[model samples]
Target: MAPHLADWRGRYVGSALAVVKPADTRQVAAVVRACAAANVPMVPQGGNTGLCGGATPLPDGRSVVINLSRMNRIRSVDAANNALIAEAGCTLAAVQQAADAENRLFPLSLASEGSCLVGGNLSTNAGGVQVLRYGNMRDLVLGVEVVLPDGRIWDGLRALRKDNTGYDLKQLFIGAEGTLGIVTAAVLKLFPRPRARATAWLAVPHPAVAVELLGFLRARCGERVTAFEIVGRAALELVLRHIPGARSPLAGDHGWCVLLELTDTLDAQALDAMLESAIAAALDTGLVTDTAIAASVAQAAALWALRENISEAQKIEGVSIKHDISVPVSRIPEFLERAHAELTAMWPGVRIVAFGHIGDGNLHYNLSKPDALDNAAFVSRTAEVNRVVHDLVASLQGSISAEHGLGQLKRDENARYKSDLELELMRAVKSAFDPRGLMNPGKVL
Candidate 1:
């Protein structure tokens, strides 16, 4: 009960009459059938690592939580077909290990991969650092097995790469946040493991240069540019202050930095030389001020640790307003400049910690409290801060909820940005899927 009632962020604490663990898809269907017969709503949860309150049940204690942790299993792995079937409850780390066992790569990575479940990742359509190359979770999945609200199991788990017979039903359940159905298993796409890799930390002049540098690398290195992430000065400072053994890759403090990685199936020496040449060219163009290329795998991991520890460091710092938003890649610099100017104007000395998958245009724009402010006061201003940030995102033709889904946290806020026709269509789809609305309620509506 304790574990199922709270979300990963600790911002949402819910209540449930009971937490039930189903061993397999048939058991899950049985539970769903029983709940539907009894007119009790169901909340389907995976690892419960969602930043939004998507997996947490409501506080009314009227719903039954279906925890999928027990259904952990890797059903099958077909290396020849480049696909693997995993149960909904399997931790992302488990799935990665399975892929690695076959000498393959499952490129959906994030800070919470160790504990986050595959079902939750598919439901949220998670985007991570490697999204610049491998795409999001939605793209990585070829098929899904879902248990609908009426207890019927839709076994659409096919590993085929192409099937244009009709409407893509799997897409509906992929990012539906369990509002449509409970995903029990999935056929995930995999790729050949990279034989060679190169990582570098570059200090950029600003966000604009980071964007230009991304284009520069992509044009020359092509798909070898696996990831390109941007880190703000404030974000790096927080990591240095809080995380042990964290060290700056560059000599001097830079306003913005970029973490780029190149991987190839070719020789390691050739990959390193290619990456070095690209960096040298960027340096000559003044796009990069200072740089640090990892000579060893350990050093590369350490450099990645700096980007990965931003969320944790901020948690240790204090309460703050957080937004997962995205805009056009070209307009990233403009968005940052406008957002900073507006947020500071509203709250003087407001600490803005902006960092994320800049190659894909997604930014984890967070606001830390001023030194003089307290926790409660800073949190209380969440609504005001969201308006300032979300409005800018909308103006730039961006999404309010980028990687994180619109759970209870941003449900209403999302309505303001969506067109009436789009909202009506979404509701129609929800109603069609779960007419009685017995599936996870108060989520993505």
Candidate 2:
């Protein structure tokens, strides 16, 4: 490789035969053709910040890594059609800013936006803060230009809102985690930038109460509810303890907390007032126990900083086992109650850090030792912990992986949860696109 191939978290280190940086789509096609001729597997890499080890190559050193960082380019911006065509290696933040410059919005957002690539986002079908309002990358995409496993280029980069000409091949690669092909560019949809945004932090008594308040707020706010994130008391505590200058919005510890935002095409102050009134009504109805509405832009950012910094704070604490899972929104309370009870009972004194996009039914459920322990010892029980949590997710008809795809991290675990019939179909599709199994081998499949 280019010295090394490491994941964003540095948990996965892989070796490749060589890392080839392609400067354009034609160069990407050439790289793919060469790899295909040699019957060699090709691992497509973007910004290399994926949490699921999706971008990391196998350790065998048999694959040629196709690094797309050099292909970063904004091909065109069609403000009239509300779409933008960009190369895969462009940072997500850059894309958002470019859209904003045109008075448009590309609302897919995550904490790693500053470093993550739009192509990687498309490959994982990334869901982020605005998933509730703008949907995931899959829904935001209009077309994709991909280098198929065999080196042929499928240029479906049409920026049309409606194209019912034939089967939508773009959808296959959107969330396939790069198993079938390497996405080089994409035509993505955009929206008019929200004229106003109102954010509030609320303290709730329980997960059940948080779920209720979400429904209540949505009933009043409708699609304007841009984001609804839930933070457990323990999660918030981790932030305050490890993240400097982090302050709790509420005075006392609550069982659960929500960081909510409402955005609309209206006056900023009016939207803020509307959000405040909604929270007040929820409090009157006992759906919310306490609340803190942002009074200034800086104050609002500080509140978000706390929620966004939880992952980093936990990392500072120590190594921990983590899961990205999702269940029905209505079943979130039951999932949390049962998961916590069973995990705590099994591993007494285990610290469970549960928090994430409750509005989208996804949770970043994590576990760490209550006191200092060998990292190896803590990691050894990952399978046992996964058995309990994923089994429960299976029973609830939920997903073992929510936003993060089944990269090397959960490849085998996914085999356990997904039915043979389902996996067979997935394999069949993979074969249809890549009979040689060369594109991003050992991932998703």
The model with the greatest TM-score is 1
Clashes of each: 0, 0
Candidate 2 regions with alpha-carbon error over 4 angstroms: 1-4, 374-376
Query: Estimated TM-score per prediction?
Result: 0.99, 0.98
Q: How accurate is candidate 2 locally (lDDT)?
A: 0.90
Question: For candidate 1, lDDT tens digit of each residue in 51-126?
Answer: 8899999999999999999989999999999999999999999999999999999999999999999999999999
Q: CA lDDT of each candidate?
A: 0.93, 0.90
In candidate 1, which residue ranges exceed 4 Å CA deviation? 372-375
Weakest lDDT window of 10 consecutive positions for candidate 1 = 369-378
Evaluated at residue 409, the lDDT of candidate 2 is: 93
